[model samples]
Target chain A: MSPKTACFLVIGNEVLSGRTRDSNTQTLAHALNAQGIILSEVRVIPDIPQRIIDAVTECRARFDMVFTSGGIGPTHDDITTACVAEAFGVALRCHQESYDALNALFPEEAFNQARQKMAWLPEGSTPIKNTVSTAPGFSIGNVHVMAGVPSIFRAMVQWLVPQLEAGAPLTMCSWHAFNVYEGTFAEALTTLQGDFKTIDLGSYPFARDDKHGVALVAKGYDSHAVQEAGRALKSLLTQIGVTPISGEPAP
Target chain B: MSPKTACFLVIGNEVLSGRTRDSNTQTLAHALNAQGIILSEVRVIPDIPQRIIDAVTECRARFDMVFTSGGIGPTHDDITTACVAEAFGVALRCHQESYDALNALFPEEAFNQARQKMAWLPEGSTPIKNTVSTAPGFSIGNVHVMAGVPSIFRAMVQWLVPQLEAGAPLTMCSWHAFNVYEGTFAEALTTLQGDFKTIDLGSYPFARDDKHGVALVAKGYDSHAVQEAGRALKSLLTQIGVTPISGEPAP
Candidate 1:
């Protein structure tokens, strides 16, 4: 069966401006894979309303599930909630449950309008619980709006994963050899790939510890196919007169 | 002056599979900002033809320039050159200069079809020099194809940046205050943002060394406005009874 697909919309001017390196994409990529869902695409957009609307609308229409990280905070730049509402053509309203949760967590004196903005959500959307902070993320349609903070984004994914339809999980095997060059085995690896059409092969060359080498990875839904490909890859490496190392090389 | 915009298309299955962390995007983001070009969008896509073609076609149409990284290597999975040609409805052909360069760099005995594939480029696309590796990346129209390897990608970008139109460089100033929360300063920061409409303000909260704080960054084309915003942010922090620290907190 074809795996369920997901698209991650990473919203932030900080990432576009080079002020921050995005860790959320990688985190979601790994998590989604573990749940058998394919992360088909990831787009990092700035904190602009129209851009967010465009991305959210496109992703929600294309993928089975859509996730967004960033711009859900209580600041002037945090317009993700409103933009998402605009994308769905819904009005932004204060979610009673979320407002109650925020009130229970924060002191009455500390409950200011800016902080209160966290309770606002697109009409008909439900809240995604945020254990990291009092401010909860919300889900509208198939789209889950999460925090930009890595810790919070990671937590939100852990909560959202079980709710989505899971597909066949992808398994992988790797073989690496030091003092080897990709040009030496490129032809052979290509031939091996043709035979195992179902398995996806990747060649990543690296230079480390004063040695150069390549890591050959085989990944697919079937463990047996992945293993057979790994074996063929090792035999191919042996034919090229190189000793293959199992697993990844030590960094 | 408004900055020229560019969108990055990061094509690789390794990144989407979480097998590798993409450092190329961050490297390019920093370089583009320094050159005054606004990196308006970034899309990380798997090494699939239709997806690559869609992303390439869309980004090329939307932005002033488009840059793609990965899937240009010699391996069987490296289909970027062919897919990019299809995106522009052009034909892929082996560029003579690139072929000659590759031949000169590698031993004649090592030269094979796999290595020869690196010379292929879309019609009318010129080669970008790769100092780290002999394999040349290509640029067709506004799209610049680059290597996935961080070292090679970095070098290729250094060569391409000088060729593009540079915009007014963005400048920024930052203030950090410990033992303060976003709630403590969200109202003040919002009011300050209204006064300095030209400056882009960001509030990044952090917890470190057993203390919580927020980093207020003010960015804009005008250095004077950024300075003014920084001063106002510091004054706001002082009003909240916290002395602001200039620069990032120590790790």
Candidate 2:
């Protein structure tokens, strides 16, 4: 069975400028992989209007789902919501639920124009609840927009992933053999891939404690095929005169 | 003066599969920023030929420079070189320097077909020296390709960045205050941003030891403008009755 595809968009000037390290891509990658929604691509873009709109419009059409992190905060640089609205050709409307949730968090005066900006979302969007900050993320069509803060982005993922259409989980297995150079075993790995055409196979080289090794992985929706590929990988390692570890190499 | 714009492409399935955490983006981001080159976009794409070709073709034309990591290894999945050649409508050619370097690393018989694959590079490309590994990465037109291994990637970057044309370094300054709500001060930030029209300003929220604060940063190539914006941020904090802390908040 073909897995659903998703794209991740990380929008922030801080990320582009090296002021912030984006942890959200890995978080979303792990989350989507678990749900069998293959994370096909990830783009970390600057907080610019045309860039944001272009990425949103392009990725949304190309993939089954598009998830964006950052640029939803209550600041002058936070232009994601507006750009997304522009991308969808929709007007901004007061999301009453989010407005109420944010309103209750602060005193009347504290809920200033900046705070009110959080309440204006793309028209006809569904609000994704935020427990960290009262300002909610929203979903329109296939695109889900969330916060950029690691803590908040995680919370939103936790809330959103479970609600997504459950998919068949991918089966993964790995075998690593020490002192095995990738170039030495590249032909065998390629043949193994051909033998199990449906399975996704790759070899990654690693260096640890002055020793080198190659970690081979087999991934697919078919459990039986993945296990068969694992055994084939193990047999290949043994054939190459090295002891195969059942999982990835120790860091 | 406008800084040169660059785009980074991280080409690997391991990253998309969550099998690897990409450290190269942050490394490249910092390196590019120090050179006064703005990293406008970054894409972490899978090890797919069409995707690599499309991204390389599009980004090379779009940005002043493009940097790519991963998919240049000897393994079968490593197709970046050929794909990049295809992107430019060129052919693969034996980069004699890289070929000679790799041949020296191995005994006559040990340097097999798989290892020989690393010697072929995109036509008309100049090889970027790789200190960690014998195999070299190559640059074609505006796109520079390097290894994905953090250490090797770092070494290649160190060698590459120094050779590129240098530009004016960006000046950065920040001011933070505890118990500062972002929404409460967002208006002042907007006004301040208008006042310092050329400077790029932003406010980042942080929570430390159960207290929340907002750190305002002013960044630009103009050193005086950045410092002037920093003083304005300090005044904004003082006006709101919170003592401003110079630099970012303590973790």
Candidate 3:
């Protein structure tokens, strides 16, 4: 299958202001990559309604799917749900099923007061079940709106990813060479990368305990191609007179 | 002292495509928070030259400082230096100091071929010396352009942060209560949060070994105010018959 592309829109003033460190982006990226759905863009915008609407609308048009995190909480700053509704030209109304779920956990009178704001959903959107929180998430078209909390966001990803068609997972292999400078290995790595047109080759240089080394990672969809490239990489490293550490096979 | 605000522009297609996970944001956030410089915003844009220019220009106007990661490499895709030059309306040229450094590291002819691209910097920008690699980073106006690699970015942060003025570091304290659900302590935490106007309180609910609990964190500029809030939180937790686990004092 061809690679499926997606974008993430992280909406929160707290994150922008660095009042909070964002963990959701990394979590989503790992989950999507495991399923072979490439996340192509990530935009962190403020709580401004107009910005959210514009970002959601633009991202939805460009990517196969758009996932948004934050601005669905029970605060004045939480406006993602409404902005998403406006972007999709849908009406914002209370979802009865979500209300029932909230009410089932708490007293109706109290839950109504706390969750009335959360029940607001975009027209024609199906609610994404929230196992971690009373405030349920929803999906409008291909845009999945999930909570900002890491635990809750992770739960939603597990639920949502299986529903979407995933592309072939990329296979990767790495060769680590110690006591080697990046400059020394640059030519060979670059040549290998050029030869392997379908694979992504990355040279990550690191300094540890007064020793410098580079980890060469090769990634592609075809397992045979990846293995072939790995064998070539090992040969290249040996020819360069560097003892490369052959680690366990890449998962 | 008034709060110092900074913004980060992460320029890379690899990060946006989920090909690489970003650790620079968290490292910078924690480090900057310790120095009392608040990170106001972070935008991860692609290698698109126009987008990089737009993000840098806007962030420079909005925040006291702007730090950009990625796009500073020897490859063709590394266009951050050029985009930054365009943003500042300056000509791109090879920095002599960087060229000299590269020449010292490699044969003159070989250095000229590979390091010439890394030497390209925006006119009038001061180079941020990279002790780790030959690729010299630079700072122009209020924007500090650094390498995307985590180690290089981190070294730049350590080198650059001490040169900037920092506001008072915030004092933070936490109180944990185990085996107590958030519902049981929600009202008290909310009430305490309301009473402490100067302090910012965050209630985090966690599940551990089939048990639920809440961790109440209080942060503020004033040490005494944080301590007072912490004491009040501890008393409230005990009053609710929830056993409290006191953590380290606010730093």
lDDT of 2: 0.89
Candidate 1 per-residue C-alpha lDDT over A1-251 given as tens digits, one digit per residue, 9 for 90 to 100? 88988898999888888788888888898888888998888889999999999999989989998999988888888899999999999998998888898888778998888889999999989888898886889888899999988877888889877777788888999999988778778888888999999999999888665677889999988889999999998888889899999988776
lDDT for each residue of candidate 2 in A84-173, tens digit (9 for 90 to 100): 999999999999888888898899989998999999999989998888887899999999999987878888998998788867777799
* Tens-digit per-residue lDDT, B1-251, candidate 3: 67888888888755654556677887777777778887666778877788788888887998899989887876445678989999999998888888778778777646634457788789999998787776788999999999887888988888887777877876777788777545555556667778998876665555545556766667777779999999897888899897788862221
Question: In DockQ, how does model 3 score against the reference complex?
Answer: 0.27
Local distance difference test values of all predictions, in order: 0.88, 0.89, 0.76
True contacts kept of each: 0.60, 0.68, 0.21
TM-score of decoy 3? 0.80
| Winner by TM-score | 1
My TM-score estimates for the predictions, one after another, are 0.96, 0.96, 0.80
The DockQ-derived docking category for candidate 2 is: medium
The C-alpha stretches of model 1 lying farther than 4 A from their native spots are B208-211
TM-score of chain B of each: 0.95, 0.94, 0.90
lDDT tens digits, residue span A164-205, model 3: 887787677778787765556566666777898887666555
Instruction: Give residue A226's error in model 3 in angstroms.
Output: 5.2
Ranking by lDDT: 2, 1, 3
